[model samples]
Target: MRTSRARFWAAVALAAATVPSGLACIWDGDTLAAEVRHRGYLVLDALTGRFDRLPPEYYRKRYELASERIAKDPSALAAYDNAAVACERLGRTDEAIDWMLKKQAAMEALPVHDRAARDDARYRFHANIGTFYAHRWVAGGAKRDDPDALAALDHLTKCMAINPEAHFGREVVQLGMIEWLNSERKQSLGDHLAERVMSSVPYAMDSSNNVLAEGLAGLVLLGAAWESVDVYNCMAHTLNFSFDSSLSFVAALRVEELLQSGKRPLDQSEGWRITLDDAASFWEDQYKKRYRTELTKVYSQLRAAGDEYVRKRNEYVLARLAEGRHPDSDGGFWSDWTEPARVELPDRRALTRSQFALVQTLLAGGILAGVVILILVASRVSRSRKRAR
Candidate 1:
């Protein structure tokens, strides 16, 4: 690792000092930052860990604090929500679930006379519970008959009744995933990623990534399906297949990993019944047939940028998202399930006689002014050029 780091830094330094001037124009900050995000998969995984999460104790304390709030005041609804969040951070999913249920039960027991208010009130609880339930099922195991998965569907259905367009109707897309998985791969939640070539196109049409792509590729469940070709194919379909995305490379690399060795440990297995190494040839054949993207070229580009690019890109993108392009601009790994409705422009007024005349006069004057400015600028620039020549 130390030698790799030494070599990596040496390469970066040498490249920075030696790369052509024209290359500067090509590898702009945005491009470099975007490149490093997929850094581990694209080039090298040896760089920094800027995106590393906080320690579990931090989350445990957060949950405990929220729990304390509930102990002091059973009516502290916000505490219930906070506890769920803390549990999520702690990866204590079952506890996360318990908090949500407690929140719902407390909410139901609250003295609100109006039934409409009560139903409307049910929206958030249902939504949160549904999402957490889906999350639980995903991480627990990709079991077909998982009750948590089914329960999520029920809660989300109720949520949809109260508000059809909640969370950009994210629940609906999640439902598609659930239904698809439940049918044991009979359903189609998303499509294939294809490349166009003059002669042959593999994995064609399919608009690989949709709004739904983020689900399977997220931190939790995706790693477990590392050896499953079908899962890889589904991920290829499910993830928004950005040509530049590292996650996209991972789907392709899944086959390679299987070919290398499918002999993964069970008690300490990260995920998998087995490594599927026995079926490596089948996987390699599958990779040749499906994941046809030539990664060598991609590797060259990413290496040219260097491994330290990870920290640089993550920081840059996070700053960007934090500054503006977040919350909605970029479709995220998380929710945009429903976005805030776009506010419409105000209706145009019918022009009165005075309004029409004023509008015509302003337009005429503006055009005349523009013409004069254009003429003056053009004349000066033309004369200067002629003299220089």
Candidate 2:
């Protein structure tokens, strides 16, 4: 009788422990579902610019709930990503870093074959961690001995080593820029680090045909700023094949600035000038072939705009020259010329009207052809079915 009573109590105790855990799991599942629903609403609000209408603590509450749920279920990777972003937006840098690190750990824990299969995801995860570290280093005033800065470099290097062909070209350029900036403060370490960072630039340029021109230009500017002739020359080589006239023009202007500042020697400047001029010419010819009628008008307008800006810049420089002063001596030359170049051309649309029209016509024609083919296939299938019957 005593033994039976003990058994009964033991079973009751087990049930009491197991029931609450089971119930807690169910509650967590429901909570996760609700959080997902709320996240969707928040995304919609942000996209529609209604996020401002939400209470200030709305994001904080969401983040807290997401973090809590993630702690209970680490497999909820999306929750981790969301919570990290929220922490970043809320200026909780340390927490953001911690969440991203957790995400990274989870990703890396996957089997090697599985990790290889999702190379893009792996690259992005590493790149994101690197970028966060880079930002943190900068936010901390770019201390020379900052561990975050070193970690940023390490992760960024890992990202490139994983897959140079991935769409992380911008990140590579950003890394180079960070290294260059830091090199100013810690000359020997910075220079060596900057060189290491710049090594990725060529990989970035060659890894993808769709490499961003702005990223390329930024790297070029960084090279110029650092007086790294090799870095800028590498960019010039890539830009030779890029065949982007506007980008070519802008790069040419930058090279000219470097030449004027005597940072780049005459021989290097000549090669860069020829390369950029050839790129401009090549793109112009291609544009002419593609849109014969619109080519003249578009080129003329772009040329006129470039001429006007150059004329104004030259006038500023000439005034400085008349004062027996070096154009950039007081750093006013940047405001006078370089800053203007950085301003996005107001009239620069991605596609000209004729190009837009051609794209639309092609799309419409393709859709019509697809519909006609579908109808023919359906009719043939129907006849086959009837014959079979």
Candidate 3:
């Protein structure tokens, strides 16, 4: 009888363990299906711009389903992420932030063996949260002391610290934009942000210092579009080129467009209204413009820079070969070279206080003079009518 009791208790314990595991699998499957359904709705909305076509209750239902599943399984990070996105779309910013924070906590709980994957996930989450705050700040009319702006700066800083090399190009451009937007409110912070972005140029160039010369060229074009003379000068100083060689060639073409059209290629006000195809066509047209003979002098300098880079690269490779090591092994070539020093930027031209005051005074005076003339004309008409009567 005692032996029978022991066997029964053991069977009960086994069943208890198996039941929860089975239920967990079922819950996960449901959550995944819900996520897939949510994504389908997103795609439909994107194509048709018919987010309202779905009943108002549909999103609530979906959110509820995900939330319930998340309550049961705290590790449902994807569900939490989807829930956060839905909340944001529904105009529930605080709820969205809460969901994102929960998702982040779940990610942090990942085992040590998953460190690499966790870091990558953490970087993405931080960057995305930063973007959300940035959008909110813009929506709020971009106040200097806006909490959203501060949050964005903090999150983006965390993202940079985690993986500076992952998306250097895009991140640097974003930083520049943020700094420009907020400079009036916090001059020191904006200046510091710009300096940090400028510092990344050398690392980006170094990473691209191979036969393809790919990295530095794109970064230069991006910097030029952002109107960063530091980036332009860095390219010039490092490459000994004029303005028409390598990636600078593309930037020079853009400069020509700016001078001719008096419009920036990328308009900030339009935001996401400009399509990718439109951007591509604009670039294609720029590429097809007749090469300006004036740029030839700049091209000559660029060629010199290119030649010098090649000479240095070859000498470094040969040295590595002499040392009985592979030339490209672990990026040994040019690894010891020092990055270019920061160049002094030219002072920007602005109207003095007196000049600004003079312009305003002239504008006000013009309006007042026009009003006085109208009044005198009316008085004359009234007197002429009275005399006729």
Candidate 4:
């Protein structure tokens, strides 16, 4: 009997232990606290390179496990959110988006009062989506008008509207907006929007304080400002013979050439020198002085690329000019001059036109007056000669 009582008590202890696990900890308030703590720990681990403390490829495996767990539970939105955030840091944007979407769906299933955290998570997810779109747009140039970019823009805008700084959404939206403005064909709109983007840059940079993010922001601002210089050249009377866009374009082109040619800062200056005439010369100087050596290298490369692009464009322009074609306001060199060539009127036609008629009449009057004077002179001379004889 005593042995039976001992086994019963042991079984009760085991059941009590399992009760904590079986009671569905999803509704537990303490679960969120643990989740936050786990996130902090993961962040710490990532920072300290504590890979040994975590499993090999902990970020990847953890996300996978979290995804599996959420798939089974469907109510584990908090866990999924945490995993999605970690995935983002790991540069797994697609996986992150998936997890975030699940989190959003789970959040919507919850009550209004319980939705704040989930909504914030959604903001972050959308921001990353925007970033993905921006990168794609930059990569594809004129060809990135796909559904992904459109969806990214839509999500980012909604995220921004919900919470501007939520998950650093504003920066994502602003960066995407800058890319859009930069690629736009309308010069005036591009310039105005780019200026606004540059103006808001400091705020966005400060919000994240991410080095790469800030560096990109700086680069973008520099590009926009340089492009603005191009627009100024388009309208400036002083640059009628030499477009300012050429200067900017060349500066950017050289940077690109350097990057593509695998040339370094100390490489041969074969049409690759950063000269005073470069559109981003001043900006490059600032970077050289302000940034670290590595960062300076990146900035220099970007500057060179921008300059090289401009140079190639200018060379193309000069080539077209050799073919008697001209660079147009729409950023293209064309042989077709829209305006008609000037033509001079024939003397017969000149006699019929109003202004030409006036001139002709005056000329006729002058010739007649000359004839009368000559006749008078000859008659006077003839009379003088007869009297003398």
Comparing candidate 3 with candidate 4, which one achieves the higher lDDT? 3
Candidate ordering by lDDT (highest first): 2, 1, 3, 4
Score each candidate by Cα lDDT: 0.44, 0.46, 0.43, 0.39
In model 2, the number of clashes is: 0
Candidate 4 C-alpha RMSD relative to the actual structure: 34.0
Models 1 onward score TM values of 0.42, 0.40, 0.38, 0.37
Quality of model 3 by C-alpha lDDT: 0.43
Q: Tally clashing residue pairs in candidate 3.
A: 4
lDDT of 4 by residue, 1-389 (tens): 23322433333233222222110101111223333432322211111111112112434545565667677888765567556645654656576667667766776777666467666656655654555554444446534456656665676567656654332123533544444445443323222332333333333111112222222222222112222222222112111111222222333343444445664432121332333233322234555333233433544444444345445544554565556442211344433422222111111110122443343345446666777999999999999999999
Best by lDDT: 2
lDDT by residue for model 3 (133-250), tens? 7667866788775888888778777876777644324455455555556755332222233344435443221211211122222333211222333333222222211111323333
Residue 229 lDDT in candidate 1? 50
Candidates in descending TM-score order: 1, 2, 3, 4
| CA deviation > 4 Å runs, candidate 2 | 1-72, 105-113, 117-122, 185-243, 247-389
3 or 4, which is superior by TM-score?
3
Poorest 10 consecutive residues by lDDT, candidate 1: 192-201
For all candidates, the clash counts are 8, 0, 4, 21
Instruction: Judge candidate 3 at residue 89 and give its lDDT.
Output: 53
